[model samples]
Target: MDLSDKQQRPVPQGPRIDRTFFRQNKKINKINKLKNKIILVRVLTEILLGALRIVHKRNTRAP
Candidate 1:
């Protein structure tokens, strides 16, 4: 028997996340956030140190 186009068409399911998979995804997201925070802090600290070095050199030259 030949199936009609409508009958052969597949049903569409929207995105679905199972419980275990969702939990794992949340854990990974948390880890990524922490890694980003650490990188941002390290970059800011380097910039501050560079500014301090510049200020120190100017202060020493002014005397």
Candidate 2:
């Protein structure tokens, strides 16, 4: 069957967790999870850096 034919086919009405499908889905899920984690870490790091900079500025001008 052609790729377009596959695309036009109706979605399965029941769960069919075959090996290849499971593997690919798991891989894609891991990639998405990792990407989200990386984004969260980056945002947190930026916020912490900004706070530290502000604190440093205040401390330097205190004395």
lDDT of 2 by residue, 1-63 (tens): 122322232333567645666566556666666766899999999999999999999999956
TM-score of 2: 0.65
* TM-scores of the models, in the order given: 0.66, 0.65
Candidate 1: list runs displaced more than 4 Å.
1-17
On residues 1-63, what C-alpha lDDT tens digit does candidate 1 reach at each position?
A: 222323233334568646666566556666666766899999999999999999999989955
- Global lDDT of each model? 0.67, 0.67
- Return the TM-score for candidate 1, rounded to 2 decimals: 0.66
Winning candidate number (TM-score): 1
Reference-based lDDT, residue 32, model 1: 67
